[model samples]
Target: MAHYFVGDIQGCFAELQKLLLKVDFNPSKDTLWAVGDLVARGPDSLATLRFFQSLGDTGKVVLGNHDMHLLALHGKLKRNKPSDNLTPLLNAPDIESLISWLRLQPLMRELPEHNVIMTHAGVPPQWSLETLRQESQLVSQALQQADYLDALISKMYSDTAERWEPNAIGINRLRFCINALTRMRYLFVDGHLDFDCKQPPENCTNPQLRPWFDFASPLRESHTLVFGHWAALMGKVNSPKLKALDTGCCWGEYLTLWHLESDQKITQKRLKKS
Candidate 1:
């Protein structure tokens, strides 16, 4: 069985299908790992969510910022934006089931055999593997609980909580966890999260800001870290241990599919509309 890891889909379903076809992906024999942002921006969010939901055990996905935003909208905590292109997904007859499935997906996935770990954005430099697992589970568990889900989703929208505090409790802790796992891109020299910069490393003019992956982490020594979300990275990183998979498919670039064992990259460009 082969393991193929894909970048942020962002509802580009047709392109995803083309990539799968290129790789000759057999769902029965291969497992597909998605770095998240499964819905939004591109067309056909409904179909993309449905296809992943139908994959059952063969598909693995982590939650992205867009996915969390969809949850907030579903809960009436946030308004839908036209740019998100999620109207069809929200209006789908199976929307409840789709959202429920999405909520259960973890913020982090670890493949111990391959010594690989994945999150939507890069893991925080301050967190150890155990801390990462525990913190991720906290949000996932809260999201699965009907009583706490709405309140949790409501409080997850802030960027105020930047630094990680071991003793932090309540909503602040949850917000930090969500931001770090899903929305993080750059960090200040003082080791605080910077949410403002979305440019690629080379183009970033801020001297104080560094891409999150630039910081040294013990986790990188033992395992390869795969992530998506910063589409501007365009599948480039300074270190081999850090894999940036989002190639901006939804932005008219291409989708990337990485074969885990052989380290082969297969890409499919966005199809132009007729």
Candidate 2:
């Protein structure tokens, strides 16, 4: 009954299967926590979604930027460029069901037993676990409402602000929460999100910007924070309490999964270049 936290799968179903086999994943006993980007930029988005969905309650997921983009595209009938590689998924007979299932997934998940919080991008240093939970609830509620879901998704594309303000309201606030939980990477000294820097810490050109977890309290409310999304990190962060699992499987890199109890990493290389 082990728990495995996997990095961004990004539609690489074959690699995901291989990694699961390596871990000896037993859906009946083992729990799989995915860091999102489950579909897009790989060979088989449809198969990837189906396989994860098959896991049912055993598989937990957070929505990544790509995942939300897919939902937005489907919900709004927006023009999708060919490069996204989502057409096959869009054309599937059960596309609506798939999208609905994805929309219902939360942006963050807390494993009480492990004292761990999981999200696509790392949580902002400014937000507490309670704040993360409350904001996630707001987004989840909006996504569940059919009439307003599309509108919310449509508003997701707006530019993000530098920092969070507790007083902020409406769609702007929702977008801020989404951006922080799913798209954030670097941050300015004042704890504002820095959208431009994606390079690893060693190569970062600007001294003022810091990785999101740099300011993390080693443990957030005594819980470990596990996240993906920054493949440039290659599963490395300075804090023992912070775990970065994205190894850029879609970019022909490794797919990493962390065993929760022992903190062992089980990784698999990409089956082929996308």
* Model 2 TM-score (2 dp): 0.96
Name the TM-score of candidate 1: 0.98
Best-matching candidate per lDDT: 1
**Who wins the TM-score comparison?**
1
lDDT of 2 by residue, 1-274 (tens): 8999999998888998999998789999999999989988888989989988888999999999999989877876467768778899999999988988998899999898879999999887877778889998899889888765556887777656557989988888898989898899988888888887889999998989988887855346588988999999998787688889999988989899999989899999888554
Residue 101 alpha-carbon offset, candidate 2, angstroms: 0.4
Alpha carbon deviation, residue 95, candidate 2 (Å): 0.3
lDDT by residue for model 1 over 1-274, one digit each (tens)? 9999999999999999999998899999999999999989999789999999999999999999999989988887888998999988898899999988998999999999999999999899888999999999999888888865556987787879999989999888988999999999999998889999999999999999999988888898888999999999899898888889999999999999999988989999999976
Measured with C-alpha atoms, the lDDT of residue 167 in candidate 2 is: 93
Stretches of candidate 2 off by over 4 Å are 216-221
- Measured against the true structure, the TM-scores of the candidates, in listed sequence, are 0.98, 0.96
